[model samples]
Target chain A: METSTRVPNPFAKRVIVVDWGTTSLRCMLVEPDGEIARETESSRGIRFIADRAFEPELMNALSSWFDEFGNLPVIALGMITSRNGWIEVPYVRCPATASDLADGIIQRRLPNGADLYFLPGITDTTRQPFPDVMRGEETQILGFGLDKEATIVLPGTHSKWAKVGQNRILGFQTFVTGEIFALMSEHSFIAKAAAKSEGIDWESYDRGVRVAENATAGDAAFLTQLFSVRTGMLANELKSEEMQDYVSGLLIGLEFRQARDCGWMKAGDSVGIVGNDGLNDRYRRAAAIFDLVTVDGGEHAAIAGALEIFASVKARSDAA
Target chain B: METSTRVPNPFAKRVIVVDWGTTSLRCMLVEPDGEIARETESSRGIRFIADRAFEPELMNALSSWFDEFGNLPVIALGMITSRNGWIEVPYVRCPATASDLADGIIQRRLPNGADLYFLPGITDTTRQPFPDVMRGEETQILGFGLDKEATIVLPGTHSKWAKVGQNRILGFQTFVTGEIFALMSEHSFIAKAAAKSEGIDWESYDRGVRVAENATAGDAAFLTQLFSVRTGMLANELKSEEMQDYVSGLLIGLEFRQARDCGWMKAGDSVGIVGNDGLNDRYRRAAAIFDLVTVDGGEHAAIAGALEIFASVKARSDAA
Candidate 1:
């Protein structure tokens, strides 16, 4: 059924949203109503253009796209505004809202007179001992209209579990689970312990989760178990995939426990996943152990969030 | 003050002792008195010859070395006898002597009429429910005369802490400390935290040792502190070398604590290091914390171990 009327393309001027990530760059052209019109992407990520500043290369790439539709209003998110990116937008302490991000500095010039707005990353100060910072995902979280309280999990090389409240990032923690697993599997002696496997072994992974959850040895000491995987394999006790799954389960499970210990999420708290299908499934499975519900965090939410921030900025500018 | 000893003529019959490692090959021509007459080496190691049987490439390399001399009794050690090598000598459970290894197997006419004796790796049965194996180091341990009673620390990619008593390996445990440090420094996010320092920071290393010794986090979890190094550096709380030392100390210190926990060594135990100099020093410093005395595990010990094994084998063959 029809829910609401679509806003006229008052910004028929078109709003451009860019999700500049580590490995890929994605740009979406949106009408005033936040409906995607034309989308373009490239292999140009932070890694490819890291040696240079973000603007010229990004402008050159986007200029080609914008040549078709002249002088569009562009809003950029992600690592592009990081210290190494096109512009360094300072981190806004979390529990932040779209208004807070919309209030961040907007780069108005490309040295060539191209107007651009960069979103400031969010940091959660509620974490007493220290604070956690997030860049692009803040836009996505804001996009999710998670305007109220919720738990968000962004799984990747460094998986982040964050708590958001009232458009502000309450707090967050990062886990090097993916990076550790890759390192051990490819470089460490544990590689000797694992065989190439086609799929995950739930039992082994579950066992690993249990071990990680109940580990009495300190974290630094538990690394010794890495060798045990190989030893177990050599002894014919564990299959290869089981070994791999155990490794993954151990890491993810530990991260799960750590997040819980940090008081980031409760047993009944809802968790939202902002990642791909495989990672989402893994998080769901892990979160299920704690009986947590998860919501979808797809591209649409990110675009919605960016557009909301844009609308707020336009409103404030018009008011001023 | 002169000790009576047997001195073989420089031109006397020579025995070729082959030390084949994972990366390099070294052949030593020894006199009856166990002194080196000639030494030659090649870049051929197990990794380079992994696809080929150990005998042909090894025999070719030895023949080139022996082209200088004539036929000689050839004794080989190291990865040459691993499952992928020339021959796979099954492990002989420890409480074993040099004679046990020497008399284990002899691979004859290996691509040539060269009489080759393959050393059997040693294994420990003392650890209940499992056993550990060692291939090349058995000869070195024997050469050190450590068969009777002693504690040996063989540092490498996988450092082995072993206890020998009454001519048998009482027990041993493996610590992947070196490899873990390497992986953490090079591959893991911890590398981002560490200041790339060329030299060692003893103080920071010591501090890391203390932290690892008293680690409270679980194994994979303690890695979270790695970010603290970067944070600490950015916050001006620590220097680059200090970060390196901290990481190094944590890994080594954790290993030390684990070895101690495993009852691998006692406070008053004499620890003999059988590896390279740098690792030996690190181990010595770590051992110092526990008041354990350490001795040099030099090339002489390895040679002596090989020669001792040879003598034991000769004696056993004579008995047979």
Candidate 2:
């Protein structure tokens, strides 16, 4: 709640961006323009950092850059800002802009006198079943740029589909497609039948997407379609090696289908694909099936979004 | 495929009913009237039985039964009859009868001179995305009685929604709801938040069922709704122990909803709940939210169906 006075010309200096999660810590020393100056990472996730020890653990990763850069302002995102993180910051309810995210930031001074600003995740309270929440994807949505209205797809463990326009994330939903894919591949019955393959089998993957595309919502076919990955093998249509990609394809395809059903987009719409989840191409291919034009969110969308939020905080603080 | 002469009055004597799954073998000694005289189970699943040793494993489990009753006809179902099981009996495509399943039986003689009938699984080639298949559920539908046209739900790791009437399984679809529940409770993000409970938490369970029932298919709300389990915890709306049951309720409700979308049942229709999966009461509660009246399928639906098919095979073989 207590924010220190803003230092002048903050945009010219380096900023430390931390993506803290359950099992790992990643720190990015970035120029104002979003290019990485230096990076450090370790397994000292917030979960492993004992109570009241997060600052020290975080400093362990950020100290060298701090010593060299002379007290760079730190921006923490991801689960690091969650209730289980160093300090639990409440989520900024959408429709949120960079400035609104900035307003929701919790601030503290580091041991080295550097200001630490924890960016709050955003929630889409309008979502049915429950008010949907996302910790880090909002930044990716921002990083991808919000000037143009588009249904942005940030594919990850829990993929987010957001409607961004008018400089705010209007509302969003999470699909959990990737997590389901991982669960099926690692622990479900499909795990046994599917073999580890060398790379993504686009053919197998596209076939899965097509399967999702072919299914009508009336069929309530996602779960049933999932079973086909196994049956397809039994029917000699899908090879064991192909099962992995086929399943990935099927689930991702289902996400797109579900998103459409939720009224996220329709034919002839342009969708921006963002994030660094290594699944961009697959999503692009999936988009084509749904007749959506694609726009890349570019590299460093998260970093760009982070810096944008930081700049907004400084801009407002400087004015105040 | 080779079925020999049916010795007269096979069912009047004792029948050995075997439920052979991936990891266990269960056998029941049934009198002519479908009463289970004695039951025995062992972990000697076909997978653990080593090469050509299923017969030994079966003998180990049933040697005493054979000693007292002489050679009883062994009827096997489940994954034990799949490609990985002792014999891969092909699936009988639907709109199939008990007679069709009886006709599709692959017969072999045990070393004990008993006839072992591998019951063929049934597949609905009619399903979209891929042909839907079930190994043992069709028999449950038969056991539940095919005299009346009704929707029969067999809840298990992979639950099946089936239609039966006129002494035939009209068609059916499988929903991996139970499997997804297991996966979420044990391995997904929900696992850490959910604690093992002694019994079903009806309130939490019903809340989940209601959540699913409220969401229209167009909402594509299932995946988004699952995130609420975690968010609901964050919001302090759900307790740790309640997570398991709530998720169970949600998935099962979704299953019912999806089944309805697939034209399995309507708001006013009565559905038959079968199987011994220990979740019938919970399912009955879910069925009610959609205004569905439920009929109970008696204990040992699988066994009763098995007997019915065995009788059909015997009657046809005797006539031949």
Instruction: Highest lDDT: give the candidate number.
Output: 2
Best by TM-score: 2
Q: Write the per-residue lDDT of candidate 2 for residues A1-320, one digit (tens) a residue.
A: 11111222247777888988877888888875557878877888777887657888877788788788789888889988888888888989999988899889899999889989888999887766667788888887888777767788888888889998899999988888888988999999855689999978999999989888888655555667778877788878888999999998888888888888889899899898887769998999999998998888876777878877877877887898
Tell me, per candidate, how large a share of the native contacts it keeps: 0.19, 0.63
Query: Using Cα atoms with residue i matched to residue i, what is each candidate's TM-score against the true structure?
Result: 0.73, 0.94
Q: For residues B1-320, could you state the per-residue lDDT of candidate 1 as single tens digits? A: 11112233222357787888767788887876778777877888887875675666766777766677667778788877776577778877767766676667666655556677777777764432224567777766665555357788887777777777777655566677778778888876545556677677788877766655554433223444444444445445667557777777767776777676666676777787776426777777877776788876665555667666666656666688
**Per-model CA lDDT versus the true structure:** 0.68, 0.82
Predicted complex 2: CAPRI docking category: medium
Judged by DockQ cut-offs, the docking class of candidate 1 is incorrect
- Provide the TM-score, chain A, model 2: 0.93
Q: Score the docking of each candidate (DockQ).
A: 0.17, 0.59
